[model samples]
Target: MNLYQKLVEIRKDVINFSKDTESFGYKYVSGSQAIAKIREKMDDLGVLLVPEVKNTISSTYDYINAKGKECTDHIVSGEMSYKWINSDNPEETLIVPWQLYGAQDDISKAFGSGLTYSERYFILKFFQAPTDVDDPDSRDTSNRGKGNKKGLSEAQVKRGYALGFKAGYDKANVDKQILSKFNKKIQDLTKEEYEIVCNGYEKRGGK
Candidate 1:
């Protein structure tokens, strides 16, 4: 990749690693930003990304290629499998990867599917290129959840949990105990909130 392109990709890598991005009203993150986050982790082998949908970018899997909470059984199709295990507790939940079914050609094009495993497993630090915009800052200060400053809805959060589980994090291993504390957080929130937290507990790709 050229310097300009590499610079752009670096920006994407950082933003991608910044948050869990799975629960409750995830906000919009531009392609550039996502790329910045993706670049940061390219240096390490801890990441497991999916194949790209486009031939131009197919050879290398950027953040755009990974499936949110790898739900498909590797033997079944893409040679992939993911399940969230609580590092804090044994009460782990198996999340079936839920792809946002639509007219899109592949996983990257499909929004609302869920948080990609990469997004959940690490904290993405944006490169903060000289020209990058602070998207959150552009939103209305008074606005609560509907602006760019807003975040992924409750549904998205659940998808992230699934990805984390599938990636093998173990349910919130706070003190070496498996626990889905988010379940409690979602339990009193709303139906959408509840699904995001509890549904991931269900299995994906039959055992």
Candidate 2:
């Protein structure tokens, strides 16, 4: 079988990793847990997953908080290349590239966090691994009186709309074009419409 087919087979057998760590009142599967599972299967599949750190950039922003306290934000951006190698053929290989950004008060902390974050997502996506918990960023909309319309909360809709508008407005008033195509205002858009606009923004590399 080809590398891609082998990957699909592997994904079928993979199990959802348990969340063994908690922070900020949220539970998540740590990078260590995810990598350990992948490592256990790599030898049998004759595939080696390697991550190379390509580049890193750092920037600092100064601002004041609501209390008028001076603050600084240090952001670290990193690029990573993940490679899947077939040991038997040595000629069959797959590469996936990813970029991630992290921010913290300490410079070293920012870069360290970004690197770990990138590595975790790289492994997860490549292996199509499942997690026991939903993404923390996702909101539970069932109790919000809207009866979980299309599985999105009112807050999520608002946030997605705002992101879409930001992307469109910054790019030649594309927001109006998107709204016109949907024939609806931002607040009135359905979950699918909001997702479409948000996806368009992502396709345009608008973060």
Name the candidate that leads on TM-score. Answer: 2
For candidate 1, the clash count comes to: 56
Candidate 1 per-residue C-alpha lDDT over 1-207 given as tens digits, one digit per residue, 9 for 90 to 100 = 333344355445453333322323445444444545553444432232332221111111112222344232110011223333333332433332322211123435432122342232222222442222333323322224445433344323333344334334343431122234443432134445434443444334222
Candidate 1 weakest lDDT stretch, 10 residues: 53-62
Give all candidates' CA lDDT scores: 0.33, 0.62
- Backbone-clash count (model 2): 0
TM-scores of all candidate predictions against the true structure: 0.24, 0.59
**Which residue ranges in model 2 land beyond 4 Å of their true spot?**
63-69, 139-207
Q: Can you write out model 2's per-residue Cα lDDT over 56-175, one digit (the tens) per residue? A: 556554545436798775665545688888887778999887765566679888778777877787666666566525544442442344444443443444344334333434322443
Residue-level error in angstroms, candidate 1, position 167: 3.7
Q: Model 1, 30: alpha-carbon shift in Å? A: 3.7
